[model samples]
Target: MPPETGLRIPQDNRFVLSNARVPTELVADPPPGATRDAEGALLLDLLVQNGRIAALFPAGMAPETACRVDLEGRHLWPAFIDMHTHLDCGHAIPRVRPDGTIHGGFSLTAEDWPRWTDEDLDLRMEFGIRCAHAHGVSALRSHVDSETLAYSQRHWRALDRLRAKWAGKVDLQGVTICAMEAWIGPEARALADLAADMGGILGGVTDTLDRGENGTYDALGQALDRLFALAGERELDVDLHVDQTEDLSAFTIPEIAKARLRSGFKGRVVLGHCVNLSLMPPEVIDRTLALAREADLAFVSMPTPMMYLMDRKPGRTPRWRGVTTANEIRAAGLPLAIGGDNCRDAWFAYGDHDMLDTLKQAIRVFQADEPLTGSLAMASRVPADLIGRPDLGRIGADLPANLVIFQARSLNVILARDQADRIVLKNGRQVTDPLPQHHELEAALGLLDTAS
Candidate 1:
């Protein structure tokens, strides 16, 4: 059947997606004798029903009674999963000053949190999630600040509401971001317990490591012990924000590995930032990567925000790049995923939950240009694995019908285009109007672009 001029998606979760140019590499465990053509494209049709992928058939072979939507030979892949983000805190307005440095960003966060009303929080979070969904992200793990007990609990309640609201459209996971001292206290424990009740992850920042980098790391190590203990007790995963600074010697990745080993943590351990880890000498970096691998630690790179925050000194140009050791970490065979950490927030202004934009920036910063360079996995495949959803982002029989159809033949074309044309589907139905904020969203995105 021919597609209509505008969105021709069916309201029911039953349809036949045809004329898709699926990549051979994205198909997981294809049937015997299945192969791609000379151009690495598999012209296939997907049969989706009851919110799941019923089967994969050859082009023009789907049942005639089912509603059909032609993909126009566009590339089809699994919808992206953003493994790390600060959704609850995403701001559409410019939060940081034009002359702001890293310290200024941090100060802005502390200053902004108290002023945010419940309605403002919900508005921003909803806008961010909607943007993510529109851009083909089906699942995302957002870190919410868990400072004071009351504040953290309120944010969790707000997220729960959003999660329930976006249930089938997007799977929203929350992580309680707390301070090191919180882990050792009752307030933090209550916060972690609440997070567990809400099916959220436990996380904290380890900035105290900067004070005792050369010493025994007694305080930070003890804090990790408490944090992991809470996680183990709550039966939740661990995600930490660590070493988000330009101090080259303030490395916490190694100590985190040691703490993981000491605690016998077998659950998923996700660490973000580690900017100082990027500034270390080659030998030290190798050693740290090895330790991290031994401890089974997965790294999340926030390139745009990290780049904006790192190595800023008044009246001086940045001498170092603000990126984690992506190449070295991948070389050590560790799981590495990249994320759009903050969106138009105080941390670093400007983002709209576009994973392709994130991937393009990462490709340039980390120089992962080819299939051999391991760039693709950082956004799609690796993030799915890190989020424990192996069934996502792969073409195969008997998977959820969540998928993305990019209007490009390959990644090169997709990245080169100024405006990306794409279709986002949940359960085989296209998302024509995902935003609830309406025109306010446009104004917000406009503000973000100007702020950037």
Candidate 2:
């Protein structure tokens, strides 16, 4: 165990955490005379009362308290939010992709769909949620596969049960994902109703594979229009997988923006992936970004899965990083959030649903640490706002004392290592449960023999 694990915190709900380092950006209003570290993080004392932040005091200025734990400058962060994930399909690694390509992964997942009974889904989904909670994520939004009504209902029921079970620990939200073309029929209305019933978001994919052959941009536009109309009717926010392909011609982001504007849909719209945007011509990229700005769309980039699946050819080292134009997206003054897209499933063979790991990879992949503080927001405040939960991602007075305390005191130290020894606290209490073991799922997932 790590040295920090040996430090005991007060079990009572009220206490003082002295000399804690918090990111300046995450602190709503710093107390006067607050001192900052080299990376612009504020050093302060945080008071917790009844599981919420009571107040913040400049280091060494806090009032006397019955219980005080001195962190001595250890970093503290608000619990993270992973706004884009696929928990319904998580941890089916036994159905690994054969060729290590996007299509191969899709095929394998489709073939394995029959194995997703309620028992199998509950076990795998709960396992992913536990991993995330242990790693200090307080909220997450998952895109459930909704190819058919039957499959949609089955998984939604499983998610509902898990949502209730994990309440107060992890705030769970679901979104329905299918091809945009599937939303052009009456089933679209049905799905929208189901999403609203569950307090979920409407989602679909607008990729080249989903679009019909021979430059069917017109049909794609109509499909998006119908999707937005359905979402508007139900007052549901829309999240779409857009242009996740290497083909430069596969630019569906512009169409989505146009559809959003044409439909006059006032609800929030989120566009995920858009890797082809990086491959587009400068003018095309500029035009698409302009449209996205007008539509006020949010972007979520899942670099881990995209890097693993995109631009892969047998025996050829991948040349380009399979990520969207992250810098450009942020520069456009649009919301950009990082997501843990897939975890140990057919779409991705590795992940533990850890947002810290996700943010670390994103910083390296996107060079997002220029300011460091802003990059951290991509995994926290940005996603929290996108999910319509502004109160969940920042450390402030009156907010729940959900946090991750890292032994690393500087930004460089935190990013250089995984911080696996970091401490997680929910509702002002340290989470002592170990991460759920993989062997626990062996019998449920039929991976006993395949276990390594």
Candidate 3:
């Protein structure tokens, strides 16, 4: 199809095309009989101008612009959305004892990070982002350490710098996955204020210090209210790192439900790692589902880290589910999503940096049928919208050009061969990025190659 007369996709954006064997059902095309020419495989040539989507071509049409690139033998899909991750505090260089066995995030020390310069921080951040792109992750809500004295204020500042540096390249959710020790006392309020002012997040936690004065349901509830109020006052989003446990009686997440009901905060919120939701008996899961639905809460199941760490703990044979209840959550008409909690950090050990792997894992672990239903949506527009990502998921005219190209014929193949590399497209042009730089840690920890 020729460029329409008097129609232009602005001179600033780049034009991109992907031609491969994408599953028809997964990759929706304009109606087969839609009146248009220039039809090709999954035609919807993205025109990304000014770092945003400018236009889309239909029915095998080519862009009139000369600055166009074609990706051959690759499938295009919505980029993955990783809704949960710790950005600055975890990833570090491989260390070893005098005997010389390498260690990763588990051995990472706050001292090591301060030894890094601004350039070093940028490299680390860039490496993480590149890893995400290689595995088809477009947007991420990365949690940074803002309240920790070791990092002090540096991690949040690093995140801000990285956000500006990689703004147009990929959508970055600069959030504060705050420290557990900093949640109470006078420092907590100030830290919360800083996170809100810095365009970061006020990440709440429930299972950090045990059921103490500061860790009880009542204590956690008050802290959440105060922090949420601060976040509201600053007009910031709240992404809580709640219960990563199986002992239902040991915790009380209903307070989260109560907070939502009392404050009615439905905007820009994410409930990360509700692993305990699975153990909540049918009645509790049902009630929580009702509350999450009422609050318009988005549940993100970071299957990788959540499952890996929980499995390693004793008396904690994971039941219900390692992630949250997907079937019940979705059926409740709530905005449910998924994220790769950790890539190569000690918090997690087996993430491939690919949500495709997450999807495949979700099927067997959660009893989900393969070739996921509303699957891509879990890691695409759903999370993208939550973090204010501008149209990076859907393939439509005027959406962002952050896209992925795969070599597989269908979602089934993609799921079966999770790590198979395929062509990639970013901002309407082909690009290359890799997954987490600290994967050697997982290997050393022996977390990979498990049944998960």
Runs with alpha carbons beyond 4 Å of true place in candidate 3: 1-58, 61-74, 96-120, 149-152, 179-184, 209-216, 313-321, 432-452
Give the whole-model CA lDDT for all candidates, comma-separated.
0.78, 0.87, 0.60
> Against the true structure, whose TM-score is highest?
2
lDDT by residue (tens digit), candidate 2, 118-138: 999999999999999999999
TM-score for predicted model 2 compared with the true structure: 0.96
* Model 1 misplacement above 4 A: 1-13, 37-42, 58-68, 92-100, 212-214, 434-452
Q: Where does model 2 exceed 4 Å of error?
A: 1-4, 95-98, 208-216
Candidate 1: tens digits of C-alpha lDDT, residues 364-408 = 888777553457668778888887888886767888888877767
TM-score rank order: 2, 1, 3
Pick out the ten consecutive residues of candidate 2 with the lowest summed lDDT: 1-10
lDDT of 3: 0.60
Arrange candidates, best lDDT first. 2, 1, 3
Candidate 2 whole-model C-alpha lDDT, 0 to 1: 0.87
Task: Please give the lDDT score at residue 282 for candidate 1.
Answer: 86
What would the per-residue lDDT of candidate 3 be over residues 68-157, giving only the tens digit for each residue?
Answer: 545443456766787776655334433311111112333454335554456555656666776676766777778776546345467767
